[model samples]
Target chain A: MAKKRGRADIRERFGFAVKARREELGLTQEDLAAAARIHRTYLSDVERGTRNLSLVNVERLAAALDLSLAALFGRVDAGADGA
Target chain B: MAKKRGRADIRERFGFAVKARREELGLTQEDLAAAARIHRTYLSDVERGTRNLSLVNVERLAAALDLSLAALFGRVDAGADGA
Candidate 1:
């Protein structure tokens, strides 16, 4: 049997990353959304793992978070050491 | 009123990138799936705008395709003179 991957998994991962970055920058979803020219409700949805943002919006959010696209997509390892 | 962004859009873009890279390497989906240690059916879905791959799997696929994660995620622009 093949393993299943779902949109919820992707959304959760993306939400975790976004929330981590937002907290690091001391910004709320509203602040980040404003900076990214996106709606606060959508940003809230994204942060709550209820949304799947597009690549362009992801890029915009990365810009708002002051992170490179590569860094934004990079997963946190179990090493537990901050990079 | 806000804009709608769906999983399909993301999947389609990802598929386009994967197809472009696979063709560039002159490899079939089956070959690419084998190289990436993934199922051909899943790979086909990923390349047909129906799958949302995980970060780890995306990295694996990029490596199998001999591409960096950054290159794999970077969007192609309308100014298509070839990069």
Candidate 2:
């Protein structure tokens, strides 16, 4: 059978990356949200992998965390499985 | 002033990368969208950077393009500017 439309793995993995990075910097979700110019609830959802993120939002989070887009994605890659 | 919420740069850069890679494989937008199991119109928007990408969708595109998430994102990183 084909996989489901909405991807849970991506959410969990991406959210994990965000949460890990946030914790590393000792920044709260609210703080990161403010820095990224997004809502705190959205950030919370993102960290839980319950939200789908636009590339722009990813960029915002990356900027707020002082990471390059590459670096943010690097973390996601680390947890992924593919050829 | 803070930057805009919607990032055209991510869209354009990401879309450019997807388009370039798709072309490198000689796949049309329809072909790619079919392979990715996403709609052709959605793929077009993605290629134009007019659509936001969830991690799942990004994964789908990467799968269809025979790229790892890292590789796909590597292209996005290439065109981005951050501290």
Candidate 3:
């Protein structure tokens, strides 16, 4: 049976990806949030891997970073985050 | 300027995608939820486009459906779901 994940590590990896990309673009969290048109706190939480976001929200964040959804999550393996 | 979305359309699209894949596998909502280790209602909600799930949940769903996150969302366009 496929294992259900606890989610901490995967969320952290996602957050790290977002943060790394943001830094590469020289955008602050607020700037990214503003560009993404989301609340700064929400972006912050996402960056901290503390928030579980929807695809739409993830899409928004990827756009704010000027990246594609695939590119944004290019590092993930299918089962790495899921059970 | 990019538009910030209200989320209804995007969520609907995502739900449609999930449902299509699930049906392709011939799994019922209860079966899918059980395989995903989530509640049947939650699966129903997601399939109905009524839920705004977190990344972890999305990951779980994709895993249950035997899909990669990218493969699961292969039809999306950037900025279509974001501002």
Candidate 4:
């Protein structure tokens, strides 16, 4: 994980946090996308760490996950620490 | 401040954080923009809460401010609480 961290950009880190939370809430991509009011494919791209999404979309995802923006990024920071 | 929070979008909140941090560090817009390798006008737009910037650029600002993404978002969250 430490070795992988070097290669994982912030987008990937953020995506991992989103995916982790979604799975924790027992949501599929489609379900989460609907909740966030974003396209499923866009959500898929976000989860794949391929999308450089803006803050508006990021906030939507956070709201959908019932996480504050700070909490969401806290997950990202935790992941950076290999937690 | 509480009154302002209701009307302030996330972008505006984020801009406030950037401006606050830049001020704390005694850096002008030009200085921070140069550090972030972003255009001064773009940074200005961000500071004005008008730019819905992507994560890549967000990271740049965080780096320039010597903050982690989590820390930056923490400031945003703080602002939401009228802090």
Best by TM-score: 4
lDDT by residue (A23-57, candidate 1, tens digit) is 98999788889999999999888877687565567
**Per-residue alpha-carbon lDDT of candidate 3 for residues B1-83, written as tens digits (9 for 90 to 100):** 34444533667667778888899999999999998889999888887878888778877788889977677767443324543
- Tell me each candidate's TM-score: 0.54, 0.83, 0.78, 0.89
Give the per-residue lDDT digits (tens) of candidate 2, residues B34-73: 9999999999988877887877788789889998677887
Q: What range of 10 consecutive residues in model 3 chain A has the weakest lDDT sum?
A: A1-10
Rank by TM-score (best first): 4, 2, 3, 1
| Cα lDDT of model 2 by residue, A1-83, tens digit | 23444334877778888899999999988899999989999999998889878777887888898877678877876755431
After superposing candidate 3 on the true structure, give the runs of residues whose Cα lies further than 4 Å from its correct spot. Answer: A1-8, A78-83, B1-8, B76-83
Ranking by DockQ: 4, 2, 3, 1
Task: Report the lDDT tens digits of candidate 4 across residue range A1-81.
Answer: 133345567788888999999999999999999998999999999988899999999988998999888899889877775
Number of the top lDDT candidate: 4
Which pairs clash (backbone N, Cα, C closer than 3 Å) in model 3?
A: A3-A83, A52-B54, A53-B54, A53-B55, B3-B83, B4-B83
Error of 1 at A37 (Å): 0.8
1 or 2, which is superior by TM-score? 2
Per-model RMSD to reference:
7.4, 4.4, 4.4, 3.8
- Global lDDT scores for all candidate models: 0.68, 0.81, 0.75, 0.87
State which candidate, 1 or 3, has the greater TM-score. Answer: 3
| Interface RMSD for all numbered candidates | 6.8, 3.3, 2.4, 4.1
Candidate achieving higher TM-score, 1 or 4: 4
Winner by DockQ: 4
- lDDT-based ranking: 4, 2, 3, 1
lDDT of 4 by residue, B1-83 (tens): 13334546889889999999999999999999999999999999999999999988998898899987889999998887563
Worst 10 residues of 2 chain B by lDDT: B1-10
